[model samples]
Target: MTDDLDTPVLDNHLHLDPRHGRGIDAVEDFVHLGGTHLLVVNKPSWHLGVEPDEPADFRPVFEETIDAVDAATEVLPGRAWPVLGVHPGLISRLVDERGFEPEAARDLMQGGLEVASEFVADGEALALKSGRPHYEVSDAVWDASNAVTRRAFELGAALDCAVQLHTEATEDLTDLAAVAEEVGLDPATVVKHYAEGRLAGVTPSVMSEKDRLERAAESGEPFLMETDFVDDPEKPGMVLGPKTVPRRVRWLVENGHDEAVRRAHVETPAAVYGIDTEATLE
Candidate 1:
């Protein structure tokens, strides 16, 4: 096992579901592993077998995520930020299970994002989270998903907060950038979560892949690191463990790539998220 790095790393993305394992323990472990900060992305209600007939019904998921982030901050104060959104996958779930019409699903997603925008405006959240179009869905559904995601970008522009995007692998981001630009959001404000390979005009919050990390390092590109840790007791370490980002940073430092580690785990995330690394780690 790799030891933690001297410079604490920040996990740009992670999901700490209280319904699964111990949320507090997860936060403690992340902090102990030299993780200086993180963003908690909550699962949508459809995953929990709940179909929302009203926009207010989505409130619980957002509240739960906010509470989780608050709890994590209390455990490791100033290290947690809340990220809430209507995930793109939720649209498929709503249609497949709840029999929501395409337009209805789209409307619901738009409404949920409006609520997320409200959270940003009210200072309840630091940013909005949403995913781009899914390839598996039909063209109509894909169009709707893209439209909702565009709405998220619009909200982000108005609120001056970043938008964390969940997109498919090998996606062409030029169009997304154009969409955000059209909505008045700078391309840099769209963070591509679970990112693989380098992308232009958007910040790639990479999963903990050594080869990908090394490649990004070689280019000296600014990016963020994440474990994408889904704390599900059943699946255990689904994407990567809570300590993965710190260990990756330590590994990079040992391999004479400390500068890259610093850029990914410290510089990029702080700039994109508007966090003061010194104050956060203190």
Candidate 2:
């Protein structure tokens, strides 16, 4: 991601995962290359290094991170746009990953994310006295946790922000799609990673990911791509997806799927995340 590259890039989904530092340098490199703004995604509390003992203090610290990300915007091309904070995986994907009691993996994974604090607020606890709780954890915790996330998304969106999310299960990408619609995406602004339904239904023949990207052309939902590019031959346990996204991009460019690729970032995602830019090179 250098400034010298003529290709326009929109990094719609980079984790400001606090496990990582402020991405100021990376942001500058992209911007210098004539890249436009990024849609900064928030890390879920579970992803924060905070331990369980300090669980209760979680939401405030979550707030602080958003503040920090917002501050970075002042130095960006424009004030950087933010995604309201929440890890959709907190309730589903993360929980399953943690080896929690194998809850029914529905449209999304279940069990929810780890928390830094136990729920203590009385009124906040009251909201979930009934059924169908939305909190990633128990009913008692849902109120406050849900509030923090809602507020983060609200503030970010009000600022014309875009939300970045990780789907809980591999097949849950469509659910993320549904969530984007619910968030009132304006187009091209919504972003989901590891999308393209490569992992839609794990099997033997679904092995060729590039083939899957070609198949996904019909659905036309937009996506973003990134690479930690981790390839460990010893860890065949890891997903095979790392090889796919960039290949898909080049494939799009080669096969005139650039319009399809561009739609995922600029138009469809922009509308979903409320982005004002076209995500194209000027």
Candidate 3:
């Protein structure tokens, strides 16, 4: 593959946990491989050693995420931005393991998202991250998770920021788009993280797999690329490695997919996140 470093490569969804992962060192690895930008999302609350009993409890979790972004920025300059919110899987954890009622669990998650919105309002973060669990759950828990997601959409609409989603694997996102429409949020700004292919509705931050990258490149769709690197030291490279995005971009360009590179790495991200990817390069 080509080793050109001119293209602005952005990892749309990534995490840096200093407590349990390589943290800033992992970000350095990504940058060394030609990555240029990142949307550093928050890890789960429990992962940060915080068990939220109220809305304010999420503050520490979000603060840690912002801190990580700050650290990454010091390493990569203005190329990293934070996307904070309550992880939707928290609903199941609250209901099943933490002995919380479904409705109460939903309220807690919504409240946590409200706290996260304040961060976006203060310009500490670029976008909000929220979505339903990617696994099967009881109907009550499912409904509660949807409510929390809708609250996130409302918050995003008010802040005029994108909402990165983490949900079940699906090619069709029409139903989720409907939810965003009902909440009066732009469906185009709702990014599907870990997306495998061209989703029917909403923006797709396609995961950096060789086949998926090739398909997204061949389709010529306006999409973004991400590694979704968990950065967990225990399970290193569990989701995808941090270097995957830039490496995939090189592969695409060498395979005569320059247009896809421009769109995925620059155009689409600028359109969705309202940030100049090229500016960071200069």
Candidate 4:
């Protein structure tokens, strides 16, 4: 079943927060659909409804993320990878919803990211997920959000780990990369999550769209493919189904673009996360 596609997919972004869907079954189902690797992200304030005061407060969230990935790895072994961090959206939530002061929120977020960076250093997770300037917040919150996000990148640089970005749809990447470089983090390690358009230096984790996939394939751009499956039962398959990336890979192969599938699904993720695809499958 896994070899049917001949090019196994590495789902770079997925949420298995237990509150959203059947935890281990979703992973097994994704594996059955020809997915070989999964980067499971933890959503603290988003899914778990937790507020951050200090970095230690985020340890429980990171531990939960580790437990989820460990459970999946128990089922699928090396195929499960964890991505732990304070999601950018949480910045706004803390400021606006929880009535937290901007500085306090920023401090909490930075502390949480410090904890995530430790996990990355310990090899328990691959990346610290954070991004600049969630566009929907108020002006003050937006400014504070970008400040905290910048600190996360600096933490990544200090820890020598990758950072996964979640920002607006039309956000620019050059400025983000500049921030990364200024903080001593390599721009190449910064991944734009749920990306739609092309960028100059940053790597995008694209969804399964014919035009988007074709453009990425034709441009010879270095990018990874993902479904960004939220796995929420209420809005099941909202962004895309679990099999979306595998189906898109099949579509590409059928259309005589097998090499593109290999680059996007296999080579790129392996290089980015430094994981062995075959070892994961085994």
Highest TM-score scorer: 3
For model 4 the local lDDT of residue 133 reads: 55
Local distance difference test, per candidate? 0.80, 0.39, 0.88, 0.77
lDDT: worst 10-residue window of model 1: 1-10
TM for candidate 3 is 0.97
Every model's TM-score: 0.93, 0.48, 0.97, 0.92
Q: On residues 1-282, what C-alpha lDDT tens digit does candidate 2 reach at each position?
A: 343322334444443433355346545544554445454544444556532222243456345545645655655554444433335434334333543332222112111111211111211110000012233455433433344333333333444444333433344434333433455532233343544444332110122256555655444544444432222334333453232333445555678676656664456444554444543234
Error of 4 at 239 (Å): 1.5
Model 3 Cα lDDT, one tens digit per residue, 104-151 = 999999999999999999999899999999998999989998888999
lDDT of 4 by residue, 33-82 (tens): 67777788886455775666667888888888889888887766346789
The root-mean-square deviation over C-alpha atoms between each candidate and the true structure, in angstroms, is 1.9, 9.9, 1.4, 1.9
Off by over 4 Å in 4: none
- Name the lDDT value of residue 169 in candidate 2: 30
Predict model 1's lDDT versus the native. 0.80
Candidate number with the higher TM-score (3 or 4):
3
Count backbone clashes in candidate 4. 0
Query: Model 1: per-residue lDDT, tens digit, 75-108?
Result: 7634688888888888887788789987888888
Q: Please list all clashing residue pairs in model 4, or write none if there are none.
A: none
